[model samples]
Target: MKTNSEKTIFEMSVPGRKGFRCAPSDVPAADLPEGLARGALPLPELSELDVVRHYTRLSRLNYSVDGGFYPLGSCTMKYNPKACEKAAAMTGLSALHPLQPIETVQGALLILHETQTILCELGGMAAGSLTPAAGAQAEFCGVKMIAAYLRDQGQTQRKVMLIPDSAHGTNPASSVMCGFACKPVKTNARGNVDLEDLARYCGDELAGIMITNPNTLGLFDENILDVTRMVHEAGGLVYGDGANMNALLGIVKPAALGIDVMHYNLHKTFSTPHGGGGPGAGAVCCVEKLADYLPGPVAAVIEEMTDEEPPVYGLVEPKKSIGMVRAFWGHFAIILRAYVYCMMVGKNGMREIGETATLNANYLMAALKDVYPLPYDRVCMHEFVLDAKWKDAPGIRAFDVAKRMMDYGLHPPTYYFPLIVHEALMIEPTETESKDVLDAFINVMRSIAEEAKTNPELLTNAPVETPFGRLDEVKAAKDLKVAV
Candidate 1:
């Protein structure tokens, strides 16, 4: 049974329908160039009302942070404030072009400059560049800076980047892209980096370590400082993956914890629009030693503040800079949204974001641990991982539970990830959710556990209530059907 929303817009096209019809032209129409003219195009022809209703119905089929609970771990799919959206859409900011004169766009330049400063201050770094387009790009920029710094210091032998088993997959990829060989560091029983394993890899060939605190497993490394010290003592710079910055916010600074450089995912931590192949921003910050190698041009104040005149804000390329990693001055609209988020949250609220996110994750972890097996059973930072392999129902898996979640109208937590844990169901109930929502989610999870034991087939043939039922995922992946 196909739903009304399932029909493609093209399928609804009528022969002579028109959503809009231009009035007869007052001026003479100019003829197009020989190659520019086209015959009839295959666009859908529909009335204005038909188009609006079609899109509205189709939108209801999609899930969003605003629609319901999104417990996607490490991704931080939290509800962003609408006020930030309004700020980003403001005419003065949104209407300005990147090619506009610097003097004419002082307000935007000031915001960009202040945002860079704020990110550096928050991460405890001396300088930063808001030129990287996204978190992955920012990570690339950071690792490249480390490589440049090592080469400049004549330590070209530092070719190894030690990465923990629980680190985000991007860590090793970014290191390799920067020409550094990656070595996997083991995780201890307590979910922290294995100091013994890490120490063995620390040598003259060590480039650095790319660590994600409150790592992908949703646990903070207990021996983080020690780990960084070991690498630093071995003459290796530490590259912190700031994807988990939501868990630290105002609570701790990455640089103070021995991170030489890091990237801030504005989309994840700062509540900018996330996940939909974004116009995202990543602000990369570094200690004074590596500041010169940051990607340029970063926002900066060309002139000092004075009594009579305001300071002049401009873009500056750092000496020995890695050069432009992106077009223009990063994603301005996304950066503007982040700035608004920071200003609105304030200092105390920033701390609250970190604390409440931890509390929420712990709440869910404590509630679900009795049913789902928690691999590293301890207090989690801002997320927790669960092994969704129920011994009572061997047929049920994390993927089944995830699909079943859609039946309850809640988006599933990330499943089978961070690879270290078997059948991992990583959940991060961000600080934005209320207790009522959390309680409802907990109840739903408990019910799912019961169903897994009593009716294993229900778990296997999951998402019966959704628009689409459980699919043959492997076959779907192997032979995709993107369009109808």
Candidate 2:
């Protein structure tokens, strides 16, 4: 909801007003290309103080990790440490141009090279390519590599990719983009993949199977080894969507579990800042068997010298590369932040992160299982899902509970996701959040549940405390009234 004092810059504009007073030009006027330039720009006119105040107020209105408890489920909206930001902003690394001479930016090259090494070790892969722009792009890279590998092996007819019913929505899209028809497998009542259904889908045409470990349902597939083995018997590879890697760090290695290829959301799992339309980094890691087919220009050690002299790092293409995914190397600053985060928290710290995150999630699940309907009433990895369909109060929905949270000054969990569960409210209490914060969140949710039973009108007309109440969401979507 908007504060009454806030207005669009345009609305606050006054004619002849100026934020700056520029001196008169003494040199000759510059010529413009014919029809290439415009007359006066339509920027808002305001004093410097007015512009600053307006932006400051707008910033305050936003919900941030720094401001409150943001349990945005699979997104992993944890607090990003300021140390990583400072390290990423260092001029030695930040100012080094991507196209600069290799000899000039040895330190920058070392950072990229070492970061790749750390990620490969962490994900239990022989090599890694940190060039994919985001998680879905990383999935596309892995699937495309599988396609190229199959083509090279003369298996042109192998064009079906099996994805589980509870897999990320991007998995099927990535498969289709890589020229593979998607065959959706079912999720059993226990939340693991249905082995019979998976076996039914596997055949000579099976290109690969893309599975999200510790899947969107927040349950680790216990029979993952068997799932991979079945795919192998059918002559198909396996791709791991490592978006949920936060739950598996230091506990299990995907490669050891027979995952041939996978991608890591460095921004989510490695403590780099994400969300709010910011840039992201997704490092694609592949096992030794598929190392030669990775995306090109992976950070590599070009030369080895004496102990006194450090090893030289440079970009080198894989044996059967898929060419460049992005223009240059990956997002350097994002990679730098993730690298710093890894260094700050060594192997033990990484293990602690996974453990604490899992414990926090289980704690919330135990506290609220009675208040809400727990779809899979088992121990969750790092998140859990709850249903909003109360038996007594039929129409009380997930949206009402979510909106009601806002009235209590708390950001709501992700709602209506994974597509399998009805009215799903996915909550991920990251390790960074404290027990107190989790307790408050749980209490708020419990209170909302009680309100749903006693007074359904409060749930229907939720977020009454905010400046706006009960938005026509469908109409708002079709006719977006966006203000510049």
State the lDDT of candidate 2 residue by residue for 260-327, as single tens digits: 89999989998898886668998999988788888877888899977899888888999999878887
Local accuracy of candidate 1 as per-residue lDDT tens digits, 166-285:
878888889999999999999999999999999998899998999999788888888999999999999999999999999999989999999999999999999987876798898999
Residue 371 shift from truth in candidate 2, angstroms: 0.6
Which pairs of residues clash in candidate 1, taking residues 3 or more apart in a chain or in different chains? none
User: How many backbone clashes does every candidate have?
Assistant: 0, 0
- How much lDDT does candidate 1 score? 0.91
On the 0 to 100 scale, the lDDT of residue 401 in model 1 is: 95
- What would the TM-scores of all predictions be? 0.96, 0.96
Q: Lowest-scoring 10 consecutive residues by lDDT in candidate 2?
A: 1-10
RMSD of 2: 2.1
lDDT of each: 0.91, 0.89
